[model samples]
Target: MSPGADAPDTGRFALRGRIVTLDPADTVLDDGVLYVSGTLIEAVLPATAPAPPGFAGVTPLDTRGSVYPGLIELHNHLPYDVLPLWQVPKRYGNRSQWGGSGNPAYRTLVTGPMKVLGQDPRLMPAVVRYVEAKALVNGTTTSQGIALFSNAGARRMYRGVVRNVEQTDTPDLPEAASRIADVEAKDAEKFLARLKQPHRLLLHLAEGTDAAARAHFQALQFQPGKWAITENLVGIHCTGLNADDFTVFAAHGGSMVWSPLSNLLLYGKTADIAAAKEAGVLMGLGSDWSVSGSKGLLGELKAARLASTAAGSVFSDRELVAMVTRDAARILRWESALGSLGAGMRADLVVVAGTHGDPYTSLVDARDEDIRLVAVDGVARYGSGRLMRALAPGENLEPVPGTAGEHVLRLDDGTADTIVAGLSLGEATERLAGALADLPALAATPVPPITASPGGGVRWQLALDEIEPTGAELRPRLPLLSASGETHPTGPGIGALTAAPAELEPVALDALTASDDPVFLATLAGEGNLPADYAGALARLLT
Candidate 1:
């Protein structure tokens, strides 16, 4: 699913608010009228301008807030987000060091639980439904896709209410490729060719902060002078790259996705984003996964802000906002159709309450409670209950808890992944909570085998990307020569992938909204790997 796409719900609505149009001129039009007609933005006119003939008798929904382009998450591990934060034992230099069996808890804490959850049909959709809601509630409109496969070897990317970058059938929204086939990846030239096939190829690259991690990037030098990367390659977590390396990457027109929190939690440092910026490399934000990263993309924005502050403020609030919106869209070659507020662009935006202060800062500093409405394809999906009742009146909606007031979720269950389409949010959350509460029992329980046929025959299961033999490896599998002259793989090892279950322990389902989960902030405060200042600064921002 390179990882991320979306479609039209035929509806017309007039949204008047402060529009932060991430256009060429960077216009912030106050008291603007954003007219939406059938999933497209009909017009974005100034309030003083005469209404277009199209605004006949429509009642405008005045979002007493600021409207910015929807948050586009370039990277995430969706299914794994169901697990709570893993208190990483200690800071390691690279992924291989910590992800290996040296840590005894690896089997029990991460991989083991996932092995059980990924296979059981009874629980997989619950995982999908819950994680997607976790993202939507936080103002995410498009992100990486969740890959699911049936027992018959048929594969399909999970398409829910949120736009999946990998499977959009729409003409304007071109699909991206995340995972390279094993055959193509193993051969360097084929990998290069595969990259040229799609609009983007989002591969996990140079994740750790050590020489071993740097070697992964070096291996992309398939030849002495020529590198395998291209304009289409969107590398995730380039922590291993140095200034010179980023310069080389920029020369090739390559972009990167940064997961600073995940990098800091595991490797004690993140990507040299300052070098990336100086080298003129485009960058986007990724929440990695909830186990050691943020609960949602909005949380990642704050983390990026703090990191930028420590780096002598290499990026301003507006620049940081661009990374998630316009720059991100450009990276995916989607700037024309999405990423900004303009006439004829898709009607995709998020509203945060209050137009006070810097709109960019307000958005970056915003908590979940501040997000009043998040619309995709001109349709309201998640918002405050009052707004939902008014805008999305005909749709069946779900109630969600919030710190300030009750929020509501309106998802069209009729998505590409039919297995999850029938399950409601309440039912999905209840099942996930109960199943996770007793992991050992759930693991011990037998899973019904999926049949091969289509009509009443096949059922979808979660395709764990990290799990071997199921799908493409999450990380780039650029082979490197060991000191002994043997080839070593940069991605997960076979033993690591086939980890046997340790005695499973009960785990609580991760909280849906950060505003509702105080433990998220509390745990980060106590977390030894994060900066001492991060928790407090984050508290000030979110609270």
Candidate 2:
């Protein structure tokens, strides 16, 4: 969309209506507006701003509803099958006999036993894939999966989880530790490698206990930024792992996918929240699945918030929102694209209605039906029933499928050309960095040319552009750059919008033409988080 009269073509997008951008500092726009172009975020101004100039020719998408970044499910998967609780009891009739109790309380107890008793390993992967698909439609764009174990004899710790499967050590108790390490080793390797291609992978390396967790790390010869360690490799449900495992995860600088309810429901525990925090690991909360927990993140948030506080310190409502938004995006390593409402990122966004007092608490307590609209890259994917019906009577727009937008930018999807076609310089640069970063092999190598516009015309753009937090009403400044090598800085801000390829000066130029308030440019080459004298330092470099 073009900027309205009297406003500069800042290249940012405006979703209109209620816009929710999950930056770490928890900045939201009520009756919000977003400014996106190419793949960088130009600005996220309030709706009060007059439509920027040049918008006359641009097609305006009147969301007139809420908008949000695409939702991401960190510790989830594509399930092959989602059997009913009752189905499990009959399918593997003797599963309950392992505990010698057909009692419903031990339904979880039967999971390990059923699988350990020679269920084909090949089926597990497909079953997981099904669950992954379900999550996608539930506002989940990304999911995580752990290595699946085969039988009771696969891993010692896994046997311990379902000792009743083959109760050699305890009577009527599932064996938590089995000799399935060999099987798990193979299965884990396959699952991890599978996650590398196409699907965003979050490996749940549950090694039973802390001691075993450490040992697995050593065995895997894990190294930072090696062996398909894409930015999206999140560690999930890692309670049994010790400090060493945390260190290994930290050294890699990956995120942690926490499933508090599922953890408590199935294993009576969740990941070590305190340890995860101390390690600087980005923390993303999950709902697991209805099989083990509720599909709603609201419930997941309540469980994790309470659990995290008891296990550590109290977490504010904003913190809970972060777990689902900014922090979650960070863990996915998709902070540049999917998590926020900055310029150049996907226009995928969500909006809620009637939120007046507190956005975070309201969002945490938000119901599924409360979602007004969900867009995928600037287009509405899910429109509220009331809004859609009101907009076009007798028109029934299909809601977004769970996995509908997985690869929307691909050439075959008919949306290839439109990808990032309208982003600003800041967003464009960020998109460049994100796309290039995916291939660590190439990203690490030297490249030629430092031209700002690699896509030829300013309209041409690249993919990988689609994809933070706090609260307490903090004020921060973000810089804005214009087409004419000018920079305009805003007031106090939590994050900056910069350029990529380490050579373009678009952001600096943006600051020269931006508003009087302090503004900061974000860049790939730039160091992470510089609070003191940032705008001045950045200003000097860009100018």
Output the number of the lDDT-best candidate. 1
Q: What TM-score should be assigned to candidate 2? A: 0.50
lDDT tens digits, residue span 106-221, model 1: 66777767777777877888888888888888889988888888868788777677887777677787777788777666656777788777578888888788898898888777
Q: Estimate each model's TM-score.
A: 0.94, 0.50
Q: Cα lDDT of model 1 overall?
A: 0.81
Q: What 10-residue stretch in candidate 1 is worst by lDDT?
A: 1-10
**Candidate 2 wrong stretches, greater than 4 Å:** 1-14, 35-43, 57-66, 80-137, 144-201, 207-233, 243-245, 296-298, 389-543
* lDDT (C-alpha, whole model) for all candidates: 0.81, 0.40
Q: Name the top TM-score candidate.
A: 1
- Looking at candidate 2, the ten consecutive residues that score lowest on lDDT are 460-469
- Per-residue lDDT for 413 in model 2? 17
Candidate 1 Cα misplacement greater than 4 A, ranges: 1-10, 413-416, 448-456, 482-500
